[model samples]
Target: MTKHIIETVTFRLKDGVKPADFAKSATAMNAYVSGCTGFIARRLSYNADGLWIEHIEWQDMDAAKAAAAGIGAPEGNRPFLSAIDGPTVTMTHTELEVSVN
Candidate 1:
């Protein structure tokens, strides 16, 4: 079986950026991502302490990598990227293990 890939991004919003504004960006980003090949699911979450995390699931590593390489090319993603505190952004990709499910 082909294991899926999960792309995790954790970051902080730029100073003065509201959560609602960030949410709007996330919505736009999801719209663009959903149209990509192998996109499975996407979820964005936050906490009381002001941290944001986005999880995106793909069919495999290649699909995840392909989407990431061109993520900055879309205007829809521009707001989302711009709203983030660049230095605080961290990302990871992990293969899904069925045994853990």
Candidate 2:
């Protein structure tokens, strides 16, 4: 199986908006992304600066794209545009090779 990684970098939250406030929205995103076709596993991490990291493993590239396209946009993402300190960045990659220990 091939693995796909999706890195999400979000700007800091604006005044009156806390990351905690968007916890519910985050969960919805998780569910939405996890339901993708090639989805095998997923991991999410965040930093104080609002940088979010996501690692997802898929069966193949087609599956990954299908899943991501289906994810669309969730309400939580609005905070990034309106109240976040900076713009959000996303990077996606498909594995060409991998190693296991």
Candidate 3:
């Protein structure tokens, strides 16, 4: 059976970065990821506490891992990575074992 992979990342923006700029950067990153093999979907959201969250879905863990290896290399991803406060970043990936709906 094929396993689904979900990658979640929580982060805060660096000082001096604006939300509008970050949004544009994220859009670029989204486009880049969309072309990757096995990419399913992606969502960007924020909380009232100033944390930004990114949820990405992949066909499987291998695809997710492959994409991760190039996260810092693509030009389109630079803005998104540079805008993030590195120290505040937290990321995790999991395989879907159960689902209801």
Candidate 4:
């Protein structure tokens, strides 16, 4: 079987944007993400330092890359994107090394 691809995005919220506010946008963006081809699952978490991490699993790298490139276009993603401090964002994609249920 082919290994799945995992995409990790780390970012901070824009100044004055609260976590709750970001969540609402994330919830809305979920619909757009779920509709994308090869999307498998997504998880969002935050650290005490106010850093947010988003993990998305895709069927393959192509899907992950494609989704990342188009994520900003959907209306559902607008608020989510706008809530982020763009310069603080970092993203990476890696082959799934191992996973357990």
Best by lDDT: 4
Across 1-101, the per-residue lDDT of candidate 3 in tens digits comes to: 98899899999999999888899999989877998899998989998777999989999988999999988888879989999999999999988777654
* Tens digit of per-residue lDDT, candidate 2, span 1-101: 33554433334455677667655555556656666666677665678666666667777777776765655465644543454444455556657365453
By the TM-score metric, which is better: model 1 or model 4?
4
Query: Highest TM-score among the candidates is held by which one?
Result: 4
Per-residue lDDT of candidate 1, residues 1-101 (tens digit): 88999999999999999999889888988878998899998989999988899889999999999999999999879999999999999999998775332
RMSD of 3: 1.6
lDDT of residue 33 for candidate 4:
91
Model 2 accuracy (lDDT, Cα): 0.58
* TM per candidate: 0.93, 0.61, 0.91, 0.95
Q: Candidate 2: RMSD over Cα atoms?
A: 4.0
Query: How are the candidates ranked when ordered by TM-score, highest leading?
Result: 4, 1, 3, 2
Cα lDDT tens digits for candidate 4, 1-101: 88999999999998999999899899999998999999999999999999999999999998998888898888778999999999999998999989887
Clashes of 4: 0
The candidate with the higher TM-score, 1 or 3, is: 1
Q: Candidate 4, after superposition: displacement of residue 2 in Å?
A: 2.0
